[model samples]
Target: MHTLAQLRAGELSGITRLDLAEGLTEFPAQIFDLADTLEVLNLSGNALSSLPDDLHRLTRLRVLFCSDNDFTELPACLGQCQALTMIGFKANRISEVPGAALPPLLRWLILTDNRIENLPTELGERPYLQKLMLAGNRLQSLPPSLSHCHRLELIRIAANRLSELPQWLLTLPSLTWLAYAGNPLETEADAAALEGTAHIDWSALRLEQRLGEGASGVISRATWQRNGQPDTPVAVKLYKGEMTSDGSPLHEMNACITAGLHPNLIRVEGRIGDHPEGQQGLVMQLIDPSYRNLAALPSLASCSRDVYADDCRFSAEVALRIARGIASVAEHLHQQGITHGDLYGHNILLNDQGDCLLGDFGAASFHATTDNLETQALQRIEVRAFGILLGELLERIDSGLSDERRKVLEDLQRRCCQPQVLARPGFSEVVRELRSL
Candidate 1:
């Protein structure tokens, strides 16, 4: 991050990226000095309400972020930056998104936690568009023109006012990750299983050191106090009170509660009862320290894909075990009408013996578990995500893996990721097929 003093003192010459969070109320005109080489600019956490009309002077700019600002409308001048491909205005008061305010080269757009009730059809015209985030909005419906986004892969429309799921969203050729909870259509029946869960009061717990933190909350080790027995060690997740990229923390808590338990899933003991600050949280089984993440989070260059270790390799038995465990848990989730929206390998953890756990319900959402075609389509959408996951594990297989078994896994992935969404098998079928191997 650069400072206002540095830019004014001519100390930031020829820089490609600049981040300014000085809480300014106006755009600095001196930024034009670096217009020749600046490629990325972040003016977030400011009181600024508008940008300079001549922002187009940054000819080399490709990315811009103005999150946590006071903008009520998207600056139309953004359309003039021909090289701009990514834009973020999250947590702003933006209600107006001008049809002509977007650049042709746009690929990723984030407008989360806004008051947007409608979207311009021009959004679908951007051929390079891939990732879109519109969660925590007031959208009533998605533009039908988005059906043209064949290359689009991930989207989050959670915490909206949508009355129904769009038919076109089901068939997006490349879509893998999707989150649409906290809408009007979500029914209580989807979470009926959550009713039987034990609620642990905050008074009956002894908080310990923090385990980790993520976009939605912090995980900490805690000891559950039993009145007539020994205390038990457990992990607790206290959700942050803010809107996340996926959606509200409340939504995630509900999904986790409803997810219940499976052999391969992190067992949720119960909901965190009364809290001093009225915060929402969950109590779950403590994971073993020996287990490690299957892969690292995605690098900026990899876009939506995760990054694996350089020497990562697994025997056929280990690979099959991991795949089967995930598939079984996926089948269990689907049976309960839940979809693991964020199913990347980074969310998976495994031990040396191949036992794996699928944690992180931050992006989970619920859909109809009935036999309707749309529900079936929803499951297939997740099938594509599983296909990508299977392909990743296959790529790192050890030489001892038999050629026939390798071909079997490859063929399963091919079928799961086929362009025709309906042709993909359900998670139950995926479990059966993987178990057969």
Candidate 2:
């Protein structure tokens, strides 16, 4: 975090990154002094509303973040920054995105929790575009030109006004992660779907050590004691109840309840009620301490792909077992009218024996399975994501299988990730293929 004093005193002249968050109300002209060296700029949590027309003087700037500000429009001068690739303006009041505001080399664009109703056609012209997050907006339709973004891998268009899913979006060759919940096109789950869930009061539970946390909530080790039942050790997730990059915590809880129970899924014991602070929470089975995430979350350079440890290696037998477990769970989820939008390896926890437990409903959403065609296509989209994970595991193999088995695995990967959206095999078929291998 760079202070205004250091910047004005020329102490931060050759810095590659600068963060100024002291309730700035206007663009500091002194920022331009480091135009020759600055590569990243963060002015978030400020009151700035606009930027100067000649803001392009920073020729080396590659990333800019102005989130939680009062800007009502995107700065058009951003397009003049030839090296710019990432632009984030989340949680602002911006309503307009002029075509001139987008840089030609753009890759990642985040505009979550804004009032934007439309996007500029120039967005489709960026060939390097990969991740596009526009959730919590008022968009009713997507520009057809976005179909030209063949490199796009992840997109979050949840909590919007759209009434239909675009065909082009479903067929994007590289699209693997997607979330479209809380939209007009989504089918609302019946309230009774949650009736079977056990209801537990917060007062009866004894909270213990912190377990973990994610974007929407924190999980903790706790003990639950029923009136006449023995005490049970469990994990409690207290929701943060904020609008996440994917969507709302309420929607995530709904999807979790609708998903019901499965062997490979983390079991939800009950719904938490009567919280001391009036917060929503879930009571779940505590996973064994021996389990760990299959891989690390995506790194900046990998963009939308998962990153594994340097020494990570899986035998062909273990790889196939992991694949079958994930495929079976995903197939069950799709059959339940749920799409595990974020199906990366990072979301899967596995024991030493390769038994898998898929968790994290943050990016999960409900889709109508009444329409067979739409349902099948949506499931196939997730198959592509699984294919990427399968390929990653295969890449780390040190040759534990026969030539024929390796060939079969490669063939399955190709079929799952085919660009012909609906033509890709579904999760059920994927499970069968893995078993056969």
Candidate 3:
């Protein structure tokens, strides 16, 4: 959060990164003074709409962020920065994305919450491209050229206007995480799917200590008061009223409600729709305090993979239990027409007894349960995500399994992660196989 005064006074001459956000409407000429050393620049939370013509002069710049601004178009000069790899222009009014606006070495691009209708065909030419955040946009379809991007791993097209998901995405060898909620093409949840979800009133919940916070909502420890009965301790999630990196918070709440009872799922005790503050929320059964996140979120270097702790090790028995729990719950979710788009270890909570619970509907999406090809392909896509998680857990084992058990687990992983999308088995099949082990 640097000030324009400090930049103008030459106080930040040798800095490698700069953050100036005091309502800037135009690029500061003084920024060029440190072009020799600057690598990352953030001008977010400002009023800027465009960049200067000579932005290429910052030869060392590798990352740029201009989110929460008034930009109507992605600046073309940005593509001239030879070293730029990551760019963010979220929460803007951007409707135009020029073909030349893509940087030469791009890896990650964030354009969530914009009005984009189409993408530049040149985006497929960036071989290093991996993560793409395009939620809350007006895209009718994806460019056919995107099929050339074999390295793309994670993508979010939620809240868009696409009538159907491109067939090419199903066959992409590397795609793992995907979210497509809040779109017209989405299948409506069956009326009977949410038959027993209780409508909890806001006044019944007494919020207490904060449990955790994420981009879409805040979770807190609370007490669920019962009429003429004992109060029950619970966990409550109050959704934020804005587009998240994944998609709408209301979509997540809806998915949670549609996802009915599962032993390994975070039990949704009730839904809170009439909050005094007009916020949407959920009342859930409090998970045991001993259970904790299985792994940390991805680091800068491990861009799309979760990072585990140094001491994170599991026995073959414990590993099988975790695998079985996840497979069973995943089978249940898809049966209810819900897909847990983000199935990373970070979204799971576990205890020493190998009891695991899958949480986080922020990236979940609803789809049809009909026995159609499109529905089958969607489930198989998520099978790859599960394969990635199983692979991660297997790699962390300290030693506790027979060679035969190890071979079975490895083979299952290989099948799940195979380049051929249709070769992957469904969650029910995965559950049966794990049960045999």
Candidate 4:
């Protein structure tokens, strides 16, 4: 174990496995000579802009954890680490990944919370690859070649710009868990097509506990079962109340109905009744073991004040995860000409696996042929609320936020919080920029 003083002195020559993660601000370049023997290097939670150019000299390196850095682009030289198996690059400024530059031995590639717009075809050629976590990238489409990875067990492409599900993905034999909630394909036509072809019996769903409650309605947990199959747990949201000074719950139902069945935006099973009390309610899939809301705690009693306070203390990894999830959901909604009137933290829910599922669409609206300036203004207010929530989370964490993340939040605030609704960034633009961040 190297002490703080030893790291500052920067004279560790034979260190094989270096773990300088917590409470570190800078990289100790003097220890670069250990490249010959170092295998596992954990330099996370640091304020570094880039890695040493000679970092590839560690040919024997395997597990490398350098997440939460300011590197705008991954060094091409990283391919030299042929022995590398696991790589963590979460919360960085990387926009494009060079597939040929990744190590062949890579099995677990964690690149969440980055601005990756596309994946290289070469990535699918890695025979040993198993888990590819690209939850928060801006990927509009994936390379069809990914089907080549026979060993891939999990591929988390949750938040992206995908408008449709590729046919090739359905044939992957080893894949058991597939989450693509924040894609535009969640629209009505696509959902119908998927439901017809996938043979997923969604009728046997039963509502469970209420997960969240908002001014417009309440969200609950649901379980769906088919004749001889096991029950599948889901998060179901019920929309209630009439159009108030805040917004209309009917508009939200319309958005969900129009947007269709997406995994990220909380799937709507069906609607109940439209009685004298207004539009009765809606049924949705349930999300369980719910985590704390990233932006703010719900005004509901189910969420304790202490839990909200603890959420405020989220680490950089957690914050990035939430941001990525929101961006994906926003992207999907924007593609469908819909806008979430309340995109704050309280509206977004996280699962135990750190996946974000947008709920409370009771305040959402569709961008029809004519853009309603009043509605747009209300949307901007929602964006501003999201900014305040992000700022509050950062303040509570009491840690240094990278300039990239800070700039992204500030831009969101300035573009969406304006008193004039027309001054706000369109839903699509916000989603794109956030994905890049």
- Top-TM-score structure, candidate number: 1
- Which segments of candidate 3 are over 4 A away from where they belong? none
Question: Which candidate leads in lDDT?
Answer: 3
lDDT of 1 by residue, 292-318 (tens): 999998754566789999999998888
Error of 3 at 343 (Å): 0.9
By TM-score, the better pick of 1 and 4 is: 1
Better of 2 and 4 by lDDT: 2
- Residue-pair clashes, model 3: 0
What root-mean-square deviation over C-alphas does model 1 reach?
1.5
> How much does candidate 4 score in TM-score?
0.43
3 versus 4: better TM-score goes to = 3
> Where's the lowest-lDDT run of ten residues in candidate 1?
185-194
As for candidate 2, its clashing pairs are none
Against the reference, the lDDT scores of all candidates come to 0.89, 0.89, 0.90, 0.61
Model 4 local distance difference test score:
0.61
Model 4 Cα displacement at 76 (Å)?
A: 1.4
